[model samples]
Target: MADLALQFGGDLAIGPTGDLLLSEGTTLTQQRVLRRLLTNPLDYIWQLNYGAGLGKYVGQPGAPAAIAGMARTQILLEAAVVASPAPIVGVMAQTDGTVNLSLSYTDAAAGETSALTFSL
Candidate 1:
């Protein structure tokens, strides 16, 4: 694959029509899942692999905590990965099996798992 960048530019939004608005960037190129979006304008949140971030987690504003400031979790059920940005593409699965997708988050000592169950 060619070296490229995928930008997710936007606020913490699940768009008026349900589409998510993340940030714009150069590192998020040709990647498909298994990543995180940390430290938006939010507080009191915790997340695990492959989800949108809203706390003190990654990168630097030139601060170690200001990477891609905002993003939305691409839960298989929340929304489908129709298409990726320019120079970026997702790795399509090559089998028919249980696509077990799970997401965990904690806030104020309380935690929950948001699952996006689906079939192949």
Candidate 2:
């Protein structure tokens, strides 16, 4: 959610006349989007969280021991996904149930493109 978090913040826009704006619907340039994508600091944290032990919480508690926690996490994670407003910017997941990952975007440059893919 890090890059997605920032990308949500990246909310760059171009004014009808031309200028840089932010998520508030100002105006911005193509360069600003790229800048956000390249420099946003969250990429590091995003990678770690997505690639590591995200499974512990999957089990969570006594909702039901029989209920597969990993499966549950995957389901909720996926749901938080489609329900998200911003286009997904990036993702990382481990093959084992040990890790799962997702990204949600809040801000998106007009014409900007994004996709979400998962493995595990």
Candidate 3:
């Protein structure tokens, strides 16, 4: 099933036809991955453990390795990602306190590799 498309900041996307955009295939998988990483674990009532809660790292002492490890673990939990070739997660903490994250993974359903990058 296709999911309602979402912009980078989690806003609903609109299509050219004056309707809501829908996402599938690699795009959908990527969206799901980002949602999982960004959502707070306790915020989702049904599944308390569903998220990586990456926001918790913001404005705090940076631990790139630990953050990367947490991201990697969470990415693997995503059903769309392939298990054999684990996802690659890279985290960089800047002097200004912004943390950048990069991820590379194989999309199981699409049988293709994908990459995503974002900041916290």
Candidate 4:
């Protein structure tokens, strides 16, 4: 059996003409970890391990709050993708009343490093 290919947006490749777009190799792996982190678990019937539901972590943006949320976020990501190293998570409070989630992790299998930033 071959591994399935999926887009970061969770769209399996379907050509415009309704044909399956078969992605391969590095193209299939790029951003895969990040996408998994962005996905919320149980959002889909077929994929129960899809995401960490990071949106739920949105909360008051203070040093203590950020640290606590960051810890939870790291645990969620770790559970979601065991092959990836425990993520380095950082939080920044914004003047606009938003919190920034900054994350970086290395894929254990590919040795690829990824960085992502999200505002909540």
Highest lDDT among the candidates is held by which one?
Answer: 3
lDDT by residue for model 2 over 8-113, one digit each (tens)?
2336456466755333221222222333333323455655332123323433443223223333333233222232453433333333433233333332333333
Q: List runs of model 4 lying over 4 Å from the truth.
A: 1-30, 60-85
49-80 per-residue lDDT for model 3 (tens digits): 99988878766665787688789899999999
Give the lDDT ranking, best first: 3, 4, 2, 1
TM for every model, in the order presented, reads 0.18, 0.20, 0.92, 0.50
Best by TM-score: 3
Off by over 4 Å in 1: 1-48, 57-60, 63-66, 69-79, 86-120
Q: Give the TM-score ranking, best first.
A: 3, 4, 2, 1
Clashes of each: 8, 9, 0, 1
Worst 10 residues of 2 by lDDT: 1-10
Where in model 2 is the C-alpha error above 4 Å? 1-56, 61-95, 102-107, 116-120
Model 4: per-residue Cα lDDT over 20-53, one tens digit each: 7665433444345446545667885787865666
| Residue 89 lDDT, candidate 2, scale 0-100 | 33
Q: Clashing pairs in model 2?
A: 8-107, 13-27, 13-28, 14-28, 15-27, 20-27, 20-28, 21-27, 21-28
Alpha carbon lDDT of residue 64, candidate 4?
A: 33
Q: Please list the C-alpha lDDT of all candidates, in the order they appear.
A: 0.28, 0.32, 0.88, 0.55
